[model samples]
Target: MSRGLLRSTAVFSAMTLLSRIAGFARDTLQATLFGTGGAMSAFIVAYRIPNFLRRVFAEGSMSMAFVPVLNEIRERGDKAALKDFVDHMAGALCAVVLVVCGLGVLLAPAIASVFTPGWALDQPDKFAWTTQMLRITFPYLLFISMMSLAASVLNSFGKFALPAFTPVLHNLTLIAAMLWLAPQFDIRPFGLAWGVLIAGALQLVLLWPALGRLGLRPRLRAGFHHPEVRKVAKLMLPTLFSSSVAQVNLLVGTVFASLLVDGSQDWLYYSDRLIEFPLGLFGVAIGTVILPHLSRRHAATDAVGYSGALDWGLRLALLAGIPAALGLFLLAEPITATVYNYGKFEAFDSRMTAISLTLMSLGIPAFMLSKVLSPAFFARQDTKTPMRAALLTVAANVLLTIAFTTPLWLYKVEGAHGGIALATALAGIFNAWLLWRYLRRAGLLQPQPGWGRFSLQLFAACVVMATIVVGLRLWIGSWTEIAQPTHRIFWLFVVIGAGALSYAATLLASGLRPRDLRH
Candidate 1:
């Protein structure tokens, strides 16, 4: 990363950290209110429908497809032309989102059934609740897709803070719902669904002024035949399928989880949410900052800049991901026990969630690598390669999900949900491996000098961090046995702070410097 890129990434990461903290609070409240129960499972699955679409169409596909093209146009120094392109793309995307949202609402029951097959047949109450919430939450796709589009535009213009902060609105809305609206609802999670709907609108509204400040506010004019819009359409098609593989894998997990015991979906949901903390704070923040930067370099045929960006992103991902993965693996139980394990959430539920979190933590490196690397191909307008990788990943996940989940389910194992999380984690590595392999074959990503030493140093630091966490865990005893939540929270922070401090100290002692992160 260049200093400029690093600064931008830091800005985004800080905002994302705030958002993740708020998200943690929202989730903690949700777990308190619902626990790993039928209602929580229903909301989890119902919410997945639009969230999946948001990833596929809004953020993943359209944003990736739009940024490079927009960057090129902006680089050409034609503000009027750029504005025209933005308007046409906005109109086209909004039209598609409206149609999709309408269909999603209309077919909520079928959509609910497809993702949660076990619920539709054997768990009718869960099924009905899922469908109802799906109908309420599905419009989130429309609002959030537009929000994503606006954010991509801002990112392309080198404006990242507002976009990064938008998710805080989402978490705040959900937290507010949990505190107030949920109590009024007969079905408590229903309030969360409504909150999703409201937050989507608020997120989109929040970005309009940012766009206006840039004098790039879209006019919602139909121009499907505009050359740039057509190019974006072509790029979005394969990218949609390609970039959505992760979401697809999650959907696959949800399908299998639905068939497991009653609390399986909730377990996976909470575990995945915990896994997302580090990912959201660092992995995604880095990826978001890098995409437009890579797009600009790729457009200018600046191979050196492009390669350096990729190298920096990969190394930084490892630098951050390794410690995070290790910390999560070491402190999974305590993290779960502290963040959840209140009210309706029990010690058993915390144990199960921790099991899943630990298994999922094993894949953090792969997940972050994929998050940073995919944009390399996307920036070069090569979505087909990633689409191929995504297909293989989905297939592998299916086989693995079945392979790992069958015995657990058949034998009635205590932590069967962990099997699904384990499969997802393993499949993520395969997906990331394929992506890295393709990037190598295409000669798009070249490792920068010092990578070998950097890797060694990173490994050493992570080892130190892991040792500290393990030592702390041994000294503190099991979290569930702790009498007070406040003490559990204190010890959890002690372990995390000590591990982080040790990791940083070891990295410095091993000759890794702040300057080493620079490209």
Candidate 2:
């Protein structure tokens, strides 16, 4: 089981790394074409609305509800029953998502107003532009939700690679749009919106053959009365909030950010893109790969296996997340300047974005740990506990966003967006704590032996990596000051390579081994 878990995690992480690279390219083009300006801020708000719902339903809520149930059916080895349940879920999800998409399009203006009240009041044109872009992007919800359902089914059957690779398609599509399509459009960002809509259909289409190859192709028939359908629906209710709490927190941050300054939303958005690299590459991949194993352990009533899986997940999260957070924090400025300082994304924009990225990087462990911890509850079919934790998280986020940002905005602090990022980081810590407390109290998990030594070794490695990165940064100076992209790229890779090598050497000297990851 441990070997299989490690293999699956490697597969998912490799595919996710490809997707993140493509995502970075897409973002770089986006920054070059449309910098941190009023239009970009509006586009961020517009894009985030549908993207939030995508996370809420497809990535977060539905998958958490669907995967465990499907795992159970697969474990029973009842192929026909599994197919029936999948078809019913397809019908139900399709019916519901279609209606939601329609409403989203029709209500685009109203939704934009609610999400970006300050923009609406202060800059009606930007607000209007957001509504237009949002309408075009809304239908992405319907198609991508179906794709997510398909991906979840594939994941249950141990077919992880195809689904994990699907985002590469989306990123490539957006990059193409930025390069060619955006230039043709009157409003260039609208090309990005169109790209989103087109990519959604393409992703769903790509999944069809994969599902058919597995003999799990979903047939469309209303299964509103199906027992499994009802179970998923019941689970999805609480899992909605619980699984998507981070996105909800980001959305809440969007609300606060809209009122801050002209480019505040764009600054926050760029920082978020940088932070998502580590989160997507390792944090989310770990969560995705662990869910099915955890579910199997829970279904078989193997408490020891379940506890072991959770422990393994937590350990990996720390191992991957600690160095990543430290590296990002230490190299925030260079990364932002190299990746995004172009066209209108000037030196000041890079500096502002780095501030937020630095603060958010401080929460990487908290964020990644929460990813693994929440699934521990979901795999047990216990959504209510996570739902409660999610509520506390959101509340803390809202209150802290207000608490931290108010004084900054009141005192006219430049880059108040950094305060919002700090609030989010703090809230993530609180959320992770609550999740660990509840899980420990319920006896769902217990820390395995060697955790103390493991933690010390990981922390020591991170400290080494941070020292190396900071020293390299001081020696190389600002990426923004570099005249040529080739020079910037070369030095950036060098810094990253030096930091990675030092960290690996530290781990080796501390007696960490490759096989230890399997344990």
Candidate 3:
């Protein structure tokens, strides 16, 4: 970790913190307005349809393929060539995304039926609502995909903070819409869906001035025939399949959960939102900064630089992610109760969400590790490897979901939410393992002497943090009742703050310092 890397990480982490805070506010509004019910389930289903595509075509494959190539051209060619590449890719992406989104709108019913059959069978009205919402929000995928491309350009140029902070605006827009517009529309969740569109537009608009500042004026042009455009298209095909497989796993979980009970899908969605807060803040922000840096190092054939970058990323992820995971696991009930026990949400709902949160916390490291390791392959232009790993993970997810859910369904378990959580955890571990193995086999990760010391320190810190969190929870167990949201809220902060202090003190005692991060 050089000073430059540490500085970049700090900026990214700060932006991610803001984004996560706004995201929490957005989730709070949604939970209060719809609770864990059909409306919320429908909204999750509808929103996920476009979101899946956005990740696949926009942020996932496109960024993976486009950024490195852009960096290469910018390194070797002149400014005019880089500008030409951006304009061509932008036009090509728009045409492709528009056609795909239009098809998604036309086939919403069929798509929704396949992904969420239980909604179609048991709640036809909800199914129709989801279809309509999907139509309204699907175009957002197009705009945001373009936005992601623009952000990738800015990021590769070492201009990261603005693009990284863009999600804060997205979340703020949704929060405002939920607060102000939901009441005006008698349709409840429709306003939230409208907010999704507005947020996507805002995200795009917010990036343009930044692009101008970078001296790149992207225009819609017929650059589809450019050789570089074709090269990107060639890489994108397998990458798209890989991205779709990951999204399909989520749809599978949603469909399976929907079949189990009325609110199962919503419960899982809310719990996922909680886990995503840290995932976005730490895993995604780190991954965003690491990729371009790794790409440049790999291009320069600096194996030591690449390995050091990966090491620092993994270390920082463990530093923040481990304590957060432990805290979430220990205070799941209190945290859920505090954040979501309002309006239509009730005590039992909090318990269910807490169970899901605990399970998700167990998988947080796997999720973060996958984010850190996958960049190695992406930097090397090997999307197919991750695609293979993703396929295996999805298959494992389906198998584990069936195995866990069937036994619970037969035995009449009191809380089947745990089974979904366990299945997802297992799947995530499998995904992370495969990613690590592939990266090692490809000669991406070199053995470093300090890695063992770093791992030991991280494990020790996690243990100390978990012990403190559990001890504090036991000490305050009587005060934090799931039925009393206010009490739970009070204890939630106390327990978390105490645990965080304990972890930080332990890390400092273990000889880890801010200066140690500077390689």
- The C-alpha TM-scores of every prediction are 0.99, 0.99, 0.96
lDDT of 1 by residue, 214-240 (tens): 889999988689999999989888887
lDDT of each: 0.89, 0.90, 0.81
Clashing pairs in 2: none
Query: In candidate 2, what are the lDDT values of residues 212-250, reduced to their tens digit?
Result: 988889998898999988998998899887898878889
The list of candidate 3 runs beyond 4 A from truth reads 241-246, 410-412, 478-487
After the best TM-score superposition of candidate 3, give how far the Cα of residue 390 lies from its true spot, in angstroms: 1.0
Q: Name the lDDT value of residue 314 in candidate 1.
A: 93
Clashing pairs in 1: none
Return whichever of 2 and 3 wins on TM-score: 2
| Candidate 3 residue-wise lDDT, 328-429, digit = tens | 888788788788878888778878888889987888887787778877877877788888988888889889889988788678685675787788877887
Error of 2 at 494 (Å): 1.1
